[model samples]
Target: MSTPDRLIEATRELLWERGYVGTSPKAIQQHAGAGQGSMYHHFAGKPDLALAAIRRTAEEMRETAGRVLDAPGSAYERISGYLLRERDVLRGCPVGRLTMDPEVVASDALRAPVAETITWLRERLATIVREGLDRGEFTPGIAPDDIAASIVATVQGGYVLARAAGSADAFDAGVRGLLTLLAPPAGTARHTDAVVSHHPAS
Candidate 1:
């Protein structure tokens, strides 16, 4: 890879492993196998490089989530698929992890991508919930934003629980619990036609 690409990749990997507070310019340089001068030649500084890497990961995750959550099926099916799909359960969400780091959360350069990524994901998932409501696939009274936040929280919290407990079972339980909560009642129409409503839409 080119030096800049190498620098970005190294930054992402380091961020995932060490977090923003723990990673240093010298560490990035060493990880990228590039000299300090070369890294500085590309990025203005650690903040600049971190922003680039965070944006890259954000774009990748958005594309990936669109694919998984929009896959052919009822909304529950697609969402459950996304939740249950293969994962490094113990590793946690790289972007979500940054939110827990005080320094990363304080820096606009570092925090913007993390917040935007999560907001984008929540809106995307909410769209699926809205679609399901349209198709009469999910029960009413459930707020799309609330449900979307819950799903994202499950994944984020699942990782924490898994890492803390040193097992994927907690993650599995969290997802399964979500599936149970979202599943529509048997023989029930999920929504009414002509007056379908979830916060009056949008």
Candidate 2:
């Protein structure tokens, strides 16, 4: 890859593995196998490079989620696909991790992508919930936006639980729990038992 690409990729990995405070310019240069001159030549500074990396990570997250959310399936199935989709549970979420970084959260430029991606995800999920409600797949009374926020909170919180426990079981349990709550009532259009049974805990 080109020098710029190398730098961005290295920054992305470093950001995921280490927070903004830990990912230094020297560390980035060493990880990318690029010298100080090359890094400065390709980009203005660390913030510029980090922004690029963060944007890339955010875009990738959106694309991955969009695929599952847009897929041909019932609202529950599509949401199930998103929650159950393969993830490095122990490593936690790349974008979600950024929110914990003091430096990243403090900077408007650095935090924009992360915030936007999260907002986009919540909005998309809300749309799906709305669809299900409209089609009578989900019971009435629950608000789409509220349910959407809960879903995102569950996944993000699940990551923290899993990382803290040094096991993916915590994450799995959270997903199962949420799914159980989201499953329609027993005799509803989308049977609760079938929906929950379809995507067994894994």
Candidate 3:
């Protein structure tokens, strides 16, 4: 990679591993194998480089999510695909993690990408829920935007729950619970029976 690319990638990794306060410019330079002069030459400073890295992460998150959301499937299938997709649960979310950082949340420039990414996800999911309601797949009482927000909340909160417990079971349980709620009444009965049968009364 070029000097700029290297710097941005390194910053991305550092940001993921360490929050904005924890990731230093020196650490970014070392991680990138670029000297101080090269880093400064390519960018104004740490903020500039970090912004680039954050934007890249945000864009990638949107693209990956779109793949699942846009795929050929019913609303439930598409949402489930997204919720159950491969993720480094123990590592938490790359873009969502930034929302926890005080520095990132405090700065408009830094926060914009993260905020936009989440808003986009909520909007996309809401659209799918709306479609399902129109098709009589989802109950009429359920609000698209509300359920969309809850879905995002469930995933993000699942990560927090799993990380706090030091196990992915918490995350899996949360997803399963959300799936149950999302499933139709008949579908929920089958899902419940399946789960009950699999565990076999402990």
Q: Give the per-residue lDDT digits (tens) of candidate 2, residues 44-83.
A: 9999999999999999999999999999988888888888
| TM-scores, all models, native as reference | 0.89, 0.93, 0.92
lDDT of 3 by residue, 87-155 (tens): 889889999999999999999999999999999999999999999888767767899999999999998
lDDT of 1 by residue, 142-165 (tens): 899999999999989988998999
Best by TM-score: 2
lDDT measured at residue 92 in model 1 versus the true structure, 0 to 100: 79
Q: Which ten residues in a row are the worst by lDDT in model 1? A: 193-202
* Residue 87 C-alpha lDDT in model 3: 84
Report the candidate with higher TM-score, 1 versus 3. 3
Model 2 global lDDT (CA atoms, 0 to 1):
0.90
Clashing pairs in 1: none
> Which ranges of candidate 1 are over 4 A from the true structure?
188-202
lDDT of 1: 0.82
